[model samples]
Target: MPRILAVDVYQVAMPLKYPWRTAYGEDHTIETILLRLETSEGIGWGESSPLPQPHYVEQWSAAAFLCLQQCLVPAVLGRSFGSPEELQQAMAFVKGNTFAKAALDLAWWDAAARAQQKPLYQLLGGTREQVPVGADFGVMDHPEELLPLVEEAVAQGFPRVKLKFRPGWDLPVVQAVRQRFPELVLHIDCNAGYTLRDAELFEQLDRFRLAMFEQPLGYDDLWEHAQLQRRVQTPVCLDESVRSLHLARQALALGSCRWINIKPGRVGGLTVAREVLQLAAEHGVPCWVGGMLESALGARHCVALGTLPGMDYPADIFPSDRFYEEDLGDPPLVLDRDTSGRPVACPLEAPGTGTEPRPDLLRRWTVNHFHAHA
Candidate 1:
């Protein structure tokens, strides 16, 4: 049996070039917990980067940080394990701290792949070497400001574009995008910012033939979401509503969502993420991985996850260079188009995540860091 060697946790904060706004809040910096799991064979890395506050979910960077240090880290230190799944099974008792547990789970998976000297994607059963990618355009102050970005993403060959929507910004914003790029693959992320009365808003949106209307109503309101689904021409894609395998099943059984956006950190880790993919596939629901504006290290995890077979839609990944000015390190997330002009992310060939954190950057941005002995 392979005994875990060490776990190192680092708190990293990097400034974004521009503030990205959504229905939840505005963010100007990316803060995350990067975990490095070591074995005698090698090192494996994973990231748990939630937003600074709990706008997206109840878990924030600060809370997740402590959860890993005080609760999650202590649970598995120095423990022996055959595979990442085994470690994940041991972690169920920790409860609700999905992003916190995700840091450890992802590192273990990366560690397992490192031990075998195989790509994380291959170990996770990914078929495509090049992953189809998509980019999200956050809510802007003006429709004029939003158009250029959309045009640029389209010109850069991103096959799908996700736009953020709130109450006032819903109908007109999407209408304007449709007028400009009539054929752009599009969807709107409601971020659980709307109410039942807003069903009429979606009715107007139905004419645009959006790929889906994502999380249009309140979070955890599955029945209402199912109600909205039947009333609209657009498929309802759940983001905040579906967290675990059980919630996903209920969502499916209730016809709550036609699609799902699975964020590894949001769920726990790739182990549960894979389970979500399997569940989505069995029920014929389309799914995509959502990014939290991760630095290079975290984006690499997304690249690894994108390789799975059930990632049937364009993953929400971005060109690292364009997404972040500085990162832990670079991975081969270059943007290009496939035969049908769908954006593709080139998979890393080296074992594990294939990208290591740059030491200088880590030292400069690390607010705090600690080590755990196995």
Candidate 2:
């Protein structure tokens, strides 16, 4: 068991190379909460990126920071946790701040892996050396502009590509991509932008042959998604809706989705992430890891999780340079190309996530920081 002795929490805004426009809104910078846990055995790092605002999910960066500073940290600062699940249990009293709890859970897992002298993937029981990663594009100024980017991703040997789908940028854009790259594995993320009434429109999309429609309904919805899934021939993939193991089970039982996009922070952390992956696998549902534009520190955990069995689809993981001009984390992630030329990512042999925040960048980008001692 490792007893936590101190904690340092930082709220940072890492500038993006390009504005990431989604259905909800556009973000020029990714605001995230980072945790450095000092345990009896060693140090660990964790990150949870809620957008600057509450549009994507109810938890935003500032609120997640308060939840950790005022409640979550006080509950577990001096406690010894035998496992990440135990750490999660300690924070159970505070509900619905999965993003806040995730920072702690992820830190604990990183610490445990380091203490055990193993990489995070091995600790999570993943044996795969590398996993294919897909490229994702946000809403561009024009659909025609998307063609060149998609072409670049294809030229780089990416296996799949994801486009951000919104009302103004919907059918015509998808049509253009499908027409241009007829054989590319394609998908569109609605980001909870549609309702069940749009069934006719989604039905219109079946011809494009998308890999799936990700989170087409409300962020907290399940039944409506089931309705939409039943109406559309294309596979439905749930993202914002499946927040925990319980929600995952509900979605599966209702046939709400054929695929699940597992973003560790969205579902809490790696502890629940693993449970959700297992549950999805048992139900024969394909799963893939999604990114939140986190730095290499946070993305590294996602890359490690992608190697686990049942992660059938290509992940949303990207190299450091894809989003940031200069990575905020040390030893920025670089993609590897497989024999067939598909872009892939592998967990570093170093223990834990194999990356940490660069102290200078951490100091420069931090809007606020909280420190505590046990």
Candidate 3:
């Protein structure tokens, strides 16, 4: 078994190509924490973007850093774990802070994979080499500003598209997209912007025949989502609500959602994500991978998780160039198209994720850094 030798945490701010506006807020630059874990055998990298604020979830960038440096790192710094679950158990004493835990969890998984000389997906029991990915468009000032991006995504051979939905950018924006590309596979992510009071609005949206409506209610409310699901024909997909496997089971039992969006960082890294996917599979509910605008390092884990069975929906994974002009991680992620011409993302055959922060880029973007040794 490989024992953790040292850990490095970097607080980096990677500039986005444009401001990504969602229901929670707008992000001009994605401020995230990246972890580099060195083991007896090799080194591995991980990332968790809590953004600059806690509006997306309870965790934020600065808090996640402190949690890792003061809590998570100390829990398993000198420990040797045979499995990712063991590493997770070591940090079980800490409550919440899934993003902070994920930084360590992801690095352990990556390091373990590299130690065994296997692709991360293969180690995770993935059934496929590549999976289809979807393009996402954030909220724009006008439908006109959004249409061109949708058109570009379509022309680029993406199989599906996700549009950010909020109060002012709701009906009219969706109506415009539907008019332009009626047959395009479309879904809307509300980022927990609406409540059950907007059930009528969701009911009205059924006329558009979306693939699903994602996180329209409160981020932590399951009962309201269940009630909202009962009144709407479009399938409700839970994002922020499904934070853990326990929450996933509750959502399924209460009929809170028909689809689940699994993000590694949101679910405490790939260990819990795999458990949720398996749970969703057993229940016959489909699942899809979602992203947090991470650089190539984190996006690689999303791609690997997407390869598992029952991830039927196109993922929110995108190429590095989609958001960043120059990627922060080495070996920039480029989409691989299948024979059908649909854009897809594939896990690297090389050991681990085959990505890490470029030394120069890391030095340029890092606002804070912490290091600890066994």
Whichever of 1 and 3 has more lDDT, that candidate is 3
Q: Can you tell me which runs of candidate 2 are displaced by over 4 Å?
A: none
Q: How far in Å is the alpha carbon of 338 misplaced in model 2?
A: 0.9
C-alpha lDDT of all candidate models, in order: 0.83, 0.93, 0.92
Superpose all Cα atoms of candidate 1 onto the true structure and report the RMSD in Å to 1 decimal: 1.6
- Residue-level lDDT of model 3, residues 251-282, one tens digit each, is 99999999999999999999999999999988
Per-model TM-score, in order, reads: 0.96, 0.99, 0.98
Q: Cα-based RMSD of the predictions, in order? A: 1.6, 0.8, 1.0
Candidate 3 Cα lDDT to native = 0.92
Best by TM-score: 2
Better of 2 and 3 by TM-score: 2
What is the lDDT for 71 in model 2? 98
Write down the worst ten-residue block by lDDT for model 2.
Answer: 77-86
Better of 1 and 3 by TM-score: 3
On the 0 to 100 scale, the lDDT of residue 274 in model 1 is 88
Residue-level lDDT tens digits of model 2 in 1-374: 89999999999999999898999999999999999999999999999998899999888999999999999999998999888888899999998899999999888889889988899989988879898999999998898798999999999999999999989999999999999999999999999998888889999999999999999999999999999998889999999999888999999999999999999999999999999999998899989999899999999989888988989999999899989998987889999988898899989999998899999999999998999989
